[model samples]
Target: MFFKLQSLALIFLGFNAYASPLAEPNEVHISERGAGLNSFLNLLLSYLPAIDTSVTDATGIITDFDNLLGALTGAQETYNELGRSCTEWTVIFARGTAEPGNVGVLVGPPLFDALDDKFGSSAITIQGVNDYSASVQGYLAGGDSNGSAEMARQIRAAKSQCPHTKLIASGYSQGCQIVHKAIAQLDSATASWISSVLLFGDPLKGQALNSVPSSRVFTACHALDDICKNGILIGPSHLTYAVDVVNAVNFAAAH
Candidate 1:
């Protein structure tokens, strides 16, 4: 009986010694990144009104926003098994409207009515793809043309927090265009760290990405995605953004 009690005590001590918290320093770093990414959703909630007002016309925007939150937030769980993770950092490229007034889309439909009347039922075509980028530049850099430069600085900040970590930019429609410009302006050192870019229903002028590295660029187009292809004429039409990311992740894991 004395020997058995001693053995049980040893086992308990061993378990306590091995027990560690689920989150490590790297995990905390990645969590911060995820928080930054979620800030974009907050930006959307704050700025959706004064910029386009067209957001009110599309019900899909809300749905897509929810889906994006799920995908990004869930990325940690999905990547846990692989030991590869992300530190998501998302921010508003621009700011148009003030908060308080922009809050509550369902608070009686006054704002919704304004948006529907302005944008109408037809899908709004993205003509000036650079407009939002320009706005973002103004917001971040206090000027236009310097938006990409600002983005490079932001990437550097992220790198400082998480050294040699992979960066992925995923955007839909017009958002993709803004991300593309940000990628273009990135310095070579920063560019090398990019893992993949996932573009959904890209509508921006294809020429914006001309100088960007071809190997890293991928476009995901829906069959009926007339929205992105409307006015754009030429550019890389092959390879999809979503499939490329999945394949790239798998390849990296396997290797």
Candidate 2:
């Protein structure tokens, strides 16, 4: 009886340890790295409207914001159609900081091409998020809740609506921060359903290093990428991830 009781106690202790939140990884300190003049400028830019309201149409009147709303709605409809057809795997991609409406240029074309080459076009589905400011301000000031919540919702929907399909979540730069936040909030079962997570030039790399098992998470940061440097000056390397996408896809395939 004592032996059986000891075994049960050990199992309970093990489960509790596994379920606890992990200690933060040792990395460059955000406070020391993320502060300074450049960081300030980046935050300021996030507050300014990306579009100029002063631009007028041929009728000499400013275009209504409703036009932008309509375009976004149309895009969502198109994405919904694609999502409905996804059979094998779904890749939810989040764009980098301050690059709204540019995920196609930044990571989509090459990443999707690689996936199609490996699994065929119809075997994969692509969903991209670019509406958020994804700026330094959003990351530092906790304004990423909306973006993280949207990401979490999509993940949950994919799991419930497509039970057999695999899920791969990829993000770049500040987008990586959002993905990390979303993943951290997921229930263990839903988190386990994610086959892989790929991050490129991740600014929040330190904070997220232990969120998942190292085997399921892959990260690539350029040696010169200042954004991933945890508060260093922004550099040209931050703008490129073509090679990383290919590598990430390869990792996903193998896993």
Candidate 3:
């Protein structure tokens, strides 16, 4: 169901509960990855000030919310496109990550460490340059010029590696901002090449995307997770994005 901003305040506080102990990363990459996405989305949904009951269906609720956000930002077309893409790509990536089932979490530091360990074995190629520091704040914090540029470079390179394949850029928390900035930087022609962007914990101001089309960006945030509650800047505002099936099921059960 669609939630009103006002009603969100009541259930929003519940998100802080999950912020407690860090859940052990799943040995299986698909599960761990999906957990990471849920963790972040829980945080997003909790921040909502209201819930719209008119959206009785799960997918409809998300679409209605996206439409609401799109109306506010005057980007309905983009938001609609992105909403569809996120749903489609979730299955594609989840399946791909499941095969190895050892890809590791997508969070910073710990996740990156695990990824490094995986890469050492040469299981996955070093698709992007390691030039940008994977710091929690500095460049990796997202939105920094260097970090965003580095991400663009990675996408361009990855695109070249598999020219025929669709490219999906998935990120968590601050990483989401970096991905968004990179996508924003792309020219209309180049941006179209992206198959999808799955943002696990998008915290950037969706309003900031006024210049770009929303259809290319797909954001997923936790309803009771608080990792991305506070932005690097300031203010008590929380970020919100569309949720995926794995997360939708989790939230439904929680409610």
lDDT (Cα, tens digit) per residue for candidate 3, span 1-255: 346666454333443332232232221123344333444344334333343221112223333333333322222121111112112121111100101111112222222223333333122222321333334344233445565676676566555554554455555554555666776777665567765555555665353442334655555545443434533321112223233434332322232
Clashing residue pairs for model 1: 33-88, 36-90, 37-90, 93-136
Ranking by TM-score: 2, 3, 1
Candidate number of the best TM-score: 2
Q: Which of the two, 1 or 2, has more lDDT?
A: 2
Q: Write the per-residue lDDT of candidate 1 for residues 3-102, one digit (tens) a residue.
A: 3556545544543432223211221111121233334333323222111123223333333322232232221111111112323322112111110111
Candidate 3: lDDT over CA atoms?
0.38
Query: What lDDT does candidate 3 reach at residue 203?
Result: 60
In candidate 1, stretches whose alpha carbon ends up further than 4 angstroms from where it belongs are 1-56, 59-151, 205-212, 230-255
The local lDDT score (0 to 100) that residue 112 gets in candidate 1 is 17
Tell me the lDDT of model 1 at 64: 36
Q: Please name the candidate that would achieve the greatest lDDT relative to the true structure.
A: 2
User: Per-candidate RMSD vs. true structure?
Assistant: 20.6, 21.3, 16.9
CA lDDT for candidate 1: 0.34
Q: Rate the local accuracy (lDDT) of all candidates.
A: 0.34, 0.57, 0.38
